[model samples]
Target: MADEVKLYGVAGSPFVCRVKIALNLKEIKHEFVVEDLSNKSAHLIKYNPVHKQIPVLVHNGNPVSESLVIVEYIDDAWKGVPVLPQDAHEKARARFWAKFVDDKCIPAVFMAIGSHGQEQAVAEAHDQLQFLENELKDKKFFGGDSINLVDISAVFLAFWLGAAEEALGIKIVTKDKFPNLTKWSDNCINCQAVKDSLPPRDDLVSFFKMRFGKA
Candidate 1:
């Protein structure tokens, strides 16, 4: 039998969604095992002992943890639509932005949502979104006309950000404030692969409300 690809992930997790989008974009076939994060399964822990987190990709019994790492791996392991840019500089730039989204954008958005009514968190997220808006200026997508690693990395901003906004009753990616980002988010969600991979908006909003105790 051919080696099977198994993904252990949580529903409504942005990180897990990133992996799903990559897989769907690559046309990779895999079995998805939804994990209950509140009571993580032994299979999840065994595969990813260090993080013991969802979004673990188990290929031929080899487990790969971390969403971005799994994305790169999927790009390399499959010969489908390329995720990373072909040029060296462009690839590096894509990677830099992906890391930036993970390290900076996601955290800022979460802090803003979690700390609803806090001026500091909201301001911090605004600054970060402004930076992203500037980066996205003059581009249809982060990869320029097509979704790429950077776009995938920023998937949370497209879907989950709206959910956070709804849950917290706060607005961040407004047209007047972050026009570029707002447009990019629409472009991203409209992409067939992304649209297919995304969880329903209402579900995401509910998840955020429960997780953040907002709304």
Candidate 2:
């Protein structure tokens, strides 16, 4: 008997994307149940009593909240094609970049979205993008040649950050600004699984515009 896997999440969420990408990488079978965070279902409340957040992975009737946690669980549960590197040191490094993308880069892009025409906010967004560009350093992916958890994290950023940019009418993560990162983002989107999973870019742009009151 196989474990029943279900994902409760919204389409636009990066948190959800992390789990989705992991499942795709492992070629795992699962059901995606879309949720409205504004009016959450009883099951979501039951699963994640604390955060009431999206991207809850329900495995064999057990619930796992938070994206990274769910990704790790996916990695642990499915032994083949591990997302993390085999070497201890390399694994640590990959985890570091994943966390970095989550912590620093995400917040910075978000700040720019929530703030417009503010000098500090604009500068902060630029700084964050520049930092990421500097970090690229000719790497094909954040996880080297293969797209691992770190690459997943960064791709989430690229997708949503592009949305936020269009929403804010700001320029960030342009091809000229961060060439390699942009290149890698394109590669990630073009990958068969990733492309299939991606929400249409134009639809995302429209969603962001509505979210930011630009529509």
Q: Please, what are the lDDT tens digits per residue for candidate 2 over residues 1-215?
A: 98799999988777788788889888989999999888999999999999988989999999999888899889999977678888899889878877888888778777777765366876786776676677667887666767777877777666777776776687755687678778888777776656656777777788777777543
**Decoy 2 TM-score against native:** 0.91
Which one wins on lDDT? 1
Cα lDDT listed for each candidate: 0.89, 0.79
What would the per-residue lDDT of candidate 1 be over residues 69-144, giving only the tens digit for each residue?
A: 9999999998889999999999999999999998898898888888874888888988877877888888999999
Clashes of each: 0, 0
Candidate 2 lDDT for residue 140: 74
Each candidate: RMSD to true structure? 1.4, 1.9
State the weakest 10-residue window (summed lDDT) of model 1. 206-215
